[model samples]
Target: MNAKIVDQHVECYVRSLLPEHTGLLKVLEQFAKLHNVPIIHPEIAQYMSVLLEIAKPTRILEIGTAIGYSASVFASHMKRGHIDTIELNAIMAEKARETFEDLNKSVPEVSLSIHLGDAKDVIKTLEGPYDMIFIDAAKGHYQTFFETAYDLLSKNGIIVSDNVLYKGMVATDDYIVKRKITIVKRMRKYLEFITTHPNLETTVLTMGDGLAISYKKGILNE
Candidate 1:
């Protein structure tokens, strides 16, 4: 099944135009491709790099740390910051640790820590006023993750949810497979909540897969 939410040709063209990934990011991209590990799309990574530059977040909380690819991206872009990333699988967490260790050598200013546990459980244990929260974990549990992490966000913080379109499945019933029905439904509900909540102002972009960027509204002007 083609799990791309964007049109294949358009995605390909956009990716082709992106500057080549270098150093650790290049290596990790190759590794993810060869090993069939899921990481953020190159386009998403590029977009995130721009977002990081503009936001200049000092503290970031990442819900998924697969091979630490996205977390590495976040770390590299920051001049000085700390990242707390959660990975559910122990092996993946260990792998992420190695990635962070290497990243430290090159980008020593940013601190990256991998917390090994279910995101739902680990998020509760965190004391945070994070400048940004990036969610790219289990598809079905996004709402739970968002709700659980809401209090941890800093006043002007943003939450970026990835793969919300779920390969276009969440956009319509036509793309949903039988086994993914529950996930699609949940994703729809999550989207609805984020879009309509009075405390949030969200913009859903049909970029890589999909990205729902929600800003905490109550304190932005103050």
Candidate 2:
């Protein structure tokens, strides 16, 4: 889905200014482009790198494991951390395992576990207190994923939701296609809940389709 949330010129300029991806990340980026696999945008990756650096999370829970690109990126920023990632597609899960194996060789300090199953079911089986939670799976089920995983997050942890704006369709009806109407509506509902929830403070950024970063309020302050 080609959704130009940010201006094309500005996005390109921002990407141009960032450093190139090297090693396995470089290969994965190229492979994703060639195979048409949906991975995090380069700009989003860079933004997350900075956030991860600041958060310095010891445990991360990733809802989507697409070829392990984002998980690998998370591993690189971590000094010594564990990432538990879920993948629904069996083929993609195997591919992620291979990528994790390679990542192990490079960053032995970080460990990764790929859980193959529907996130809705897998999330319930997971234990709590993860330092960070990343949601990047099926768009329509984002609210379901977040609500189920909410208690799994640590007190000060943050939840990052990718593609929340959904190619700009969630923002306005003018950009909505008939086929995407349901998804757009669901996305709008999810955004409203997160933004208005008394327990959370959320900010939706317009970059990279749309990224919503949320953090719990009371417990953290307490």
- Model 2 has an lDDT value of 0.93
lDDT of 1 by residue, 62-146 (tens): 9999999999999888999899999999988888898888899999999988899999999999989999999999999999999
What TM-score should be assigned to candidate 2?
0.97
TM-score of each: 0.96, 0.97
Candidate-wise lDDT, in order: 0.92, 0.93
Once model 1 is optimally superposed onto the true structure by TM-score, how far is the C-alpha of residue 85 displaced, in angstroms? 0.2
Q: Which 10-residue window of candidate 1 scores lowest in summed lDDT?
A: 213-222
Q: Candidate 2's residue-wise lDDT over 1-222, tens digit each?
A: 556799999999999998898999999999899999999999999999999999899999999998999999999999998999999999999999999999999999999999999999999999878999999999999999999999898876899999998889998888898998899999999999999988888999999989999987655442
Instruction: Name the runs in model 1 displaced over 4 angstroms.
Output: 1-3, 219-222
- Clashing residue pair totals per candidate (backbone < 3 A): 0, 0
